[model samples]
Target: MKFLPVGYNTQDLEKQAKNKWRWQWLSECDSKGMKWTDWLKKIDVCGVAYCTFCGKTINYKSNGKKALKLHCEDGNHQKIANVVKTNSVSSILAI
Candidate 1:
């Protein structure tokens, strides 16, 4: 299984983008309903405590490193980044 756009890398480094064959392999795995354990790796945003929207800290404490999805304000809003934790947040993120 030669994954194109592939690099022989150590654990710390990750591919920035998907190459052609790697993408195909991912799609194949998807079609077969295979769980992505070996195919992909866990990545972190690395010490990103502040939110990019409101310029504050939401006090995010994750059981495991979780991915973050950012929401922006209206067309003309503050350029400052804010990380405020609201009441709606839950423990598990839905991938």
Candidate 2:
């Protein structure tokens, strides 16, 4: 998927202006009934979030949950998330 930075266009700016961030989005599960709270964190900013797995901030000012879903679906994010999960499980088993 094409990655566009926040405020890349007029529409993004408008959306950013119109919407404030929701704390509940971080706790809510996606349509697939999967929660991402393990790796997703809310920053102090209004419409930005941090992904622990990818170590990147995401802008969801306009799209909200859809934006987060897309981020989670991104190839790089998925790969990192999977690797982290593997390592975590392996570490737990070793302990």
Model number with the top TM-score: 2
Worst 10 residues of 2 by lDDT: 1-10
Per residue, candidate 1 scores C-alpha lDDT tens digits across 21-75 of 1212223222223322223322232222233234333222331122122212322
Provide the overall lDDT of each model, using Cα atoms, as 2-decimal numbers.
0.26, 0.66
lDDT of 2: 0.66
Quality of model 1 by C-alpha lDDT? 0.26
Worst 10 residues of 1 by lDDT: 75-84
Clashing pairs in 2: none
User: What's the lDDT for residue 58 in model 2?
Assistant: 83
Clash tally for model 2: 0
Collision count for each candidate, in order: 7, 0
